[model samples]
Target: MQETLFCLRVGHRLPYSMSYSNTTDFTNPSTFILLGIPGLEAAHVWLSIPFCTMYVAAVLGNFTILFIVKREPRLHAPMYYFICMLAITDLVLSTSMLPKMLSIFWFNSREIDFSACLTQMYFIHCFSVMESGILVAMAFDRYIAICDPLKHSTTLANPMVAKIGLAVVLRSAMLILPYPLLTRQWPYCKSNIIPDTHCMHIAVVKLACADTRISSYYGLFVLFCVKGLDMFFVALSYTQILRAIFRLPTKDARLKTFGTCSSHLFSILAFFIPALFSSLTYRFGQNVPLHFRVLIGNVNLLVPPMLNPITYGVRTKQIRDRLHQLFSHKDI
Candidate 1:
């Protein structure tokens, strides 16, 4: 009776279905059905409204940062350069996930082709790593400016800074390119249902029937090597920056130092805290609630892009003032 029901629900035979079976045998499943967003049905307009709003806001916020940095002559500096890179990264990163997510929400058609899935995974990883590298570059720039003020011009001169920026882009691109290629090569015999909305490395990997030990190791290695190392450098740079700030003679100078580092620090925490939680959840999957997992995953993807511009605008007087001036001039 159970077998009959399973076959009926699966729409023919168990072998062609993407649904998972309780039995030990894993060979029956072909594709995976992503249990779309927890409580929101695909056709619910109300549920998708918030996601649409976020997507629009994320794009506009980051794009405005890019525009301001490009148009404002005063913003044409090492700091803004890194910020623009960050904005660009956020734009690409959010874009890679949001459209597909919205489609799933609005249409209820969560059936992403295998190739599309791979492409989405590739870009998501690429832009995410790029954001991490750009943040590290921003921290390093602050470190040099605070710790070595006299040589700031020489240390971060146009040619040198440009080269560094290029290197950051190149490194992130190369590091993330291998994962998609490797995953696509593996044979997938298990159910294709990706539990999450987006194509995450862990969720996609877990769908494989073959041993994913190597892929898991690779994911860990990249996490530690890229995100972990970037965090370490950011911490060290901030430590030196703090020491330098304390040595400043005037209260104004001290305040200036704090103001300069504050945004970067906030941005760092925003990016890392959720990431650490996601990694922890990934490692120990048993006890966590599904909704919490979904929430964390969405935050991990969304917050960095949205918070980045806000952080800079709030913390940097120059950016804030420039924004005001730009809007005021446009009003005239």
Candidate 2:
């Protein structure tokens, strides 16, 4: 059985304690201290440098994509519009975690206030949902273009695309809003250590004095409904897209369409596969090595932002050509 000991305010500190005999047990402790960056004491400088480098790269890369889409009139289309939305989402996603992560690594301050921690969790989930929606929109765009070429323009006109984008943002925001709000309402005892680097939703909920059975069930339901459904839609879209491609009269046209969607396919895989593993690891495999768990966690958070621009730029010839032209002109 599990027990929660909530310590009321006594001066500026509160005391909370929990003990776990096995990995499956959540009732064992109310709070576990998060030891950020496992080998921090001995080689703090070495660890901080790489983290900072990745943060900068993630920011710059995502912003560059955003700028190119906004400034270039020729690149204005439904496809690039969705790409811009994705770039913006990645920017927010990275910003949500990187600043605090950098501070923790450089200054060795892992003490995050309860309010700020919940806020971070909110933005993280919000942007994550936004990214998933954008990918689904992109897949739908591809499906219309490949499967219904004659009506592609009529089906995905500017006005229709704008509405779709707005709907995506609104729906995602609504889906994730409840999670953070519910998490913040739970009182935290003095023992406020988190096992992971960031304030993960599951880890935070486990600290609550109130029963978290409803929260956990709601979270799993939301996870399956959002991520799982989006992935299934993407797969279904590609199935029709592939079928249409094979039916094409000419080989060149099939290859051209394939090239257009290749980046999206790569990005979809990169984002979802690591996320699936991270979720499974947290839910089922607590005994796994902490470093390995952390590595998977980072992959879900960092890899998507870093890979988005590279994958899109490489696969989309127009973006690649524009980048080349910009660099070549700068050399002169």
Per-model lDDT = 0.77, 0.76
Candidate 2 residue spans exceeding 4 A from truth: 1-34, 39-44, 330-332
Q: What TM-score does prediction 2 earn?
A: 0.86
lDDT of 2 by residue, 46-142 (tens): 7667666777777888788887777678889899999999998998998898777766667756667666787788888888888988999999999
Q: What is the C-alpha RMSD of each candidate to the true structure, in Å?
A: 4.0, 5.9
> In angstroms, how far off is 298's CA in candidate 2?
1.7
In terms of lDDT, the best-performing candidate is 1
lDDT of 1 by residue, 1-332 (tens): 35435445433333332333422354433334444455444234665676667767778888888888887888888888888888888889988987877776677666676767877888888888888888888899999888987888888888887898889888878888877777787666545656567888888888777888888888888889889998999899999999999999999999978888889889999988898788779668669876568668777888888888888877788888888888788641
TM-score of every model versus the real structure? 0.88, 0.86
TM-score of 1: 0.88
Best by TM-score: 1
